[model samples]
Target: MPTPGGYALVHDRTIVAERRTCRFSWVLVDSGNNINILYRDTMTQLGIEATHLQPTRMLFHDIVSGLSCSPVDRIRLDVLLGTNDHFRRGPIWFEVVDLSSPYHVLLGRPALAKFMAVPHYAYLKMKLPGPKGLITVVGDYKKSLECAKAGSKMAESLVVTEERRQSTGS
Candidate 1:
């Protein structure tokens, strides 16, 4: 079983696309896993034009819950992480999806492979090999807990709103 604080690896990230930038405090830097994900609303906020983009059908499942989520459409975009000099990365392709996760983005195996990152969950640090040398990113445990709390509240509200709508037949 993972420690309670192991989830702190989820931290802030800056995503740039089409010369537009969006900073998200809830970006999950997963381990060596291929679960790259992007929030639909976040993509829109970043000014990533989706109308012209083709959507691909994909299925996602919640491993912990053993439940299948709705099949979501995937949209591709070129995105960059961090800034230019110090902790910069990408122009890499990302597949966008609509997921109500607390995270705005989930950096998975591909990203980990690209940066050759080593994640230390206990220390809440992610180390990567930069062009010049090694770069380290520290996660904020408090922020992760705060975001999780907020997400849970939002989810509860959504459920209540849905129940009300169904009861009213609107």
Candidate 2:
């Protein structure tokens, strides 16, 4: 059984300590004194009792707010990560804050932190924000989660459109 705080995946937990990566200098993965963060299981995935993990909802404009009014706006984002860092790489329905840029997916602190995993060139290997490797909901995809039947289909269509753009540079 997978726990809510931590998961059972090796790839997701594994880290490249020696590597140097830094894509978002804007963010930081710090565990300094008084950080009170769990000493083990990465800073976010606390092995300690002091570090409390907070769960929150994210809208489309949360993370991608920086890309507003841009041509790449309105692109449906693969919910690369979700609240509680459970879901990864799937269609996440988020409310758009700005109509001009519908495709830009928002990145809350959670998404920013998780996707930062794996060092880029000169940063601490970011811990996996969401489920990084093989994750199966292990229930009913159609029954338990069906309200999304309509949105899921729409997301699929958007994905196709993005794929085409990536392949043809259009």
Which candidate leads in lDDT?
1
Per-residue alpha-carbon lDDT of candidate 2 for residues 1-170, written as tens digits (9 for 90 to 100): 22231211111122111122112111222222111111122321212122232322332221222222211111122333222456555422222232221111223333334354332212223344445553332222222123234435655665676678889998
How many angstroms is residue 98 displaced in model 1 relative to the true structure, after the best TM-score fit? 2.2
**Candidate 1 lDDT (Cα, 0 to 1):** 0.67
Per-residue accuracy of model 1 over 1-170 as CA lDDT, tens digit each: 23654555777787766647767778877775465777777787788776644566556665224445542555544444433577755644455765566778778777777767788888788888776677788787877777678777767776777678889999
Model 2, global lDDT: 0.28
TM-score of each: 0.74, 0.20
Candidate 1, residue 166: Cα displacement in angstroms equals 13
Worst 10 residues of 2 by lDDT: 32-41
Q: What are the lDDT scores of the predictions, listed in order?
A: 0.67, 0.28
lDDT of 2 at 147: 24
Candidate 1 regions exceeding 4 Å error are 1-5, 75-84, 152-170
Cα deviation at 167, candidate 1, in Å, is: 14
